[model samples]
Target: MDFEELYQDIVLDHSRRPRNFGELAEAQFHAHGDNPNCGDEVTVHLKLGANDAIDALTFTGNGCSICMASASLMTLKMKHKSRAESGELIHAFHDMLTAEQESEPDKRLGDLRVFQSVRRFPQRVKCATLPWHALEEALGKPAGGEVSFSEDTAG
Candidate 1:
């Protein structure tokens, strides 16, 4: 199969059998993000090690396929990474999701390229970005004072 086929399969598989799909009963950091336009909401929970590495990451919420799958993938990728590394990955992924053709893509996103096509759909951008933004907040970034976005509003 080609890249598109593989990407579709991954997206569908994650959507149907999402990894990290539940809550963390004892999370050190908790952050929630919402896409009001599509009604996608997710709460990410993380536990950091003494060195600020990600000891654990989990999420619980309701959202579109893209939002949930992205969260699943994000947690999967975050395991064992230092907080700083996780922040870098978050930045790279954000650039990938928000970039226009003129912007350079981050190769580290790998299979996440599936969402690149999503950029074309302005309405879905929030769906694709919700997880990354939530992750950023969970990592203790300023995140510009709690992110709330709607297709109808500035967000």
Candidate 2:
């Protein structure tokens, strides 16, 4: 099968049976993010080990298949990575999913590379990124997180 087909299968599988898909009762760090435009909301919980590695991570919420699958894959991929490494990964993933042109993904991104297709639809980008933003906040108490300004024009 072509890579897009395989990636689509991966997304479907992860969304239907998400890994680390529930709460983390022993979590040491946690945060929630919402994309009101798309109604994608997620809460990320993390437990850190010594030396700042992520010992465990999980999340809970509802949204599109892409959002759920992204959260699932994120938890799987970040299991033993240091917080610093996760931060780098966040930037890489954001860049990959938001790039305007078709581009090769970083090999280090592993299954995360599947999300490269998300770059095509600007609206869906927020669905795929909501959990990630929460994860950044979870990791950001020590490292400042970036502010995502909404376009709401209310005074």
Candidate 3:
């Protein structure tokens, strides 16, 4: 199959069998995010090391295939990474998902290139970004502003 087809398959497989689709029993940080447009919601849990590295990560949510799959993939990628590194990964992935110029590629995104197509669908952008936003919140960063989606949004 072609690259597009392979990417679709990967997304679907991850959605159907998400690798880190649950809460960590002893998480050091936690946060929630919601895509109000689609009602896709996710709660992310992170276990951090003394040095602020991610020792483990997990998530629980209900959303489209893209959202769930993206979260699963993000958890896998974040393991053993420092908060700073994970933040960089989040930026790289965001650039890959939203970049307009294919010529100026985000090399750090790696296999996350599969999400490059998501930029075309404005409504779906939130689905692809919910996890990263939640991660930021968990790290005590101000994601955007004091904007609230639902009281259901929490860490």
RMSD (Cα, Å) of model 1: 3.8
TM-score of each: 0.83, 0.86, 0.82
Best by lDDT: 2
Alpha carbon deviation, residue 63, candidate 1 (Å): 1.0
List model 2 lDDT by residue over 1-155, tens digit each. Answer: 34364359899999999999888878887787777676677888888898889999999988889899999999999999997899988988988987666678778789889888777666677778878888888887664333333322221
- Each prediction's Cα lDDT score? 0.74, 0.81, 0.76
Cα displacement (Å) at residue 132, model 2:
1.0
What's model 3's TM-score?
Answer: 0.82
For candidate 1, the 10 contiguous residues with the lowest summed lDDT are 142-151
Q: What is candidate 2's TM-score against the reference?
A: 0.86
After superposing all C-alphas onto the true structure, candidate 2 shows an RMSD in angstroms of 4.1
Q: Rank the candidates by TM-score, best first.
A: 2, 1, 3
Superposed on all Cα atoms, the candidates' RMSDs to the truth, in angstroms, are: 3.8, 4.1, 5.0
Clashing pairs in 2: none
lDDT of 3 by residue, 51-125 (tens): 878888899989998888888888888889987888888888877766666544466666666777776666677
Candidate 2, overall lDDT?
Answer: 0.81
